[model samples]
Target: MMRARTRKLIGTVALIIFLGVYAWVAAVIGAGRISLAPAWAQFAYFLAAGLLWVLPAGLLIRWMQRAD
Candidate 1:
């Protein structure tokens, strides 16, 4: 059981890293289209990016809980 827990934790960490980098890249690509966008637009863009990350993270959390 302990081993399973450790594996889940590692998997969750990897998921976070993967999702974070992917989201960042996606955001950067989106940002490139708006060269003159305002500061508020950038802030809103990141907020949207974070919200998108949450859906996958919820799945990761459920998987980690079941790993035990």
Candidate 2:
């Protein structure tokens, strides 16, 4: 069984890396593709992209909390 502390540390690191990569990709997309989108579409796209990260993060948190 994995230790709680280890899981936490690993989860934290993974989350940080994931967020960094996700943000970079989002930024690149925003700069390249989203810039040409209409105002309302840009708003919706950014809003969806911003919130989508939470889904995977939630799963990661749940996994990190497991006692096993």
Candidate 3:
């Protein structure tokens, strides 16, 4: 079992990596596929993608807080 501090550090690192990849993918998809959508649809997709990173982050945070 990891110490709380260690868990937090690992979680933070994981979160950073996850966010970087997530943003890159989102940007690529937004630039490629999303660019083909109508303006309103593109707006909606961008909005959804913007908020989508939070769910996995929340899960990671929850795990980081778990009792050892």
Candidate 4:
């Protein structure tokens, strides 16, 4: 069961990283010189999506370490 859970977690983290990269690209292209959105919006978008993967990865890593 632990092995299965770890595999699923890896898949989930990979998906999140993919989505984060896509979102970063979209944000950069959508914001133009005359755009109202702050330049930081791109960074924020990337960060928020990246954290989705990071938080769970951290938790799972911690759990696995403890399990050892």
Candidate 5:
């Protein structure tokens, strides 16, 4: 099993990479399709996209903080 420090370091890097890719994808999709959508639809899409990363990140963080 990995040590706590190793887990945190790995998790931190993973989270950074995950968020960067997620944001890029979200921006691309938002610009390509969501921009043409109605205001409400755009709002909904952006809102959901904005918050959707938390779940996976939260789980990763929990894992990172888990006892070794």
Candidate 6:
């Protein structure tokens, strides 16, 4: 029980940090490159960037919920 709780706490903190960093990086790249692209390309890039974090986050959430 303690292990699971610990995992959840760590994972939550890690997820928050990961999301913050990821959003910063994505914004940087988008401003640097995607901003200059065509409208459709910029839209595509933003769409992909927006959803890309879900995969890793989902995995982390699964790991956090797993039994010890």
lDDT, candidate 6, at 58 = 100
lDDT of 4 by residue, 1-68 (tens): 46756756775676578667866765675565325556697667556755665666666556655442
lDDT of each: 0.74, 0.95, 0.96, 0.62, 0.97, 0.96
**Predicted model with the maximum lDDT:** 5
What TM-score does prediction 5 earn?
0.97
TM-score of each: 0.56, 0.92, 0.90, 0.38, 0.97, 0.93
Rank order (by lDDT, best first): 5, 6, 3, 2, 1, 4
Mind giving the per-residue lDDT tens digits that candidate 2 earns over 1-68? 88988999999999999999999999899899799999998999899999999999999999999986
Q: What is the C-alpha RMSD of each candidate to the true structure, in Å?
A: 3.6, 0.9, 1.1, 5.6, 0.5, 1.6
Best by TM-score: 5
Residue pairs whose backbone atoms clash in candidate 6: none
| lDDT score, candidate 5, position 45 | 98
Residue 66's lDDT in candidate 2:
90
Per-residue lDDT of model 5, residues 1-68, tens digit only: 89999999999999999999999999999999899999999999999999999999999999999998
| Predicted candidate 6 versus true structure: per-residue lDDT over 1-68, tens digit per residue | 55999999999999999999999999999999788899999999999999999999999999999998
What are the per-residue Cα lDDT tens digits for candidate 1 across 1-68?
Answer: 46666868786787979887977787686669644678888777767866777777777777667734
Candidate number with the higher TM-score (1 or 6): 6
- For residue 48, give model 6's deviation from the true position in Å: 0.3
Clashing pairs in 2: none
Error of 5 at 39 (Å): 0.6
Q: Count the backbone clashes (under 3 Å) in each candidate.
A: 0, 0, 0, 0, 0, 0
**lDDT value, candidate 4, whole model:** 0.62
Query: Residue 48 CA error for candidate 2 (Å)?
Result: 0.5
The local lDDT score (0 to 100) that residue 13 gets in candidate 4 is 79
Backbone collision tally, model 4: 0
Query: For model 4, which pairs clash?
Result: none
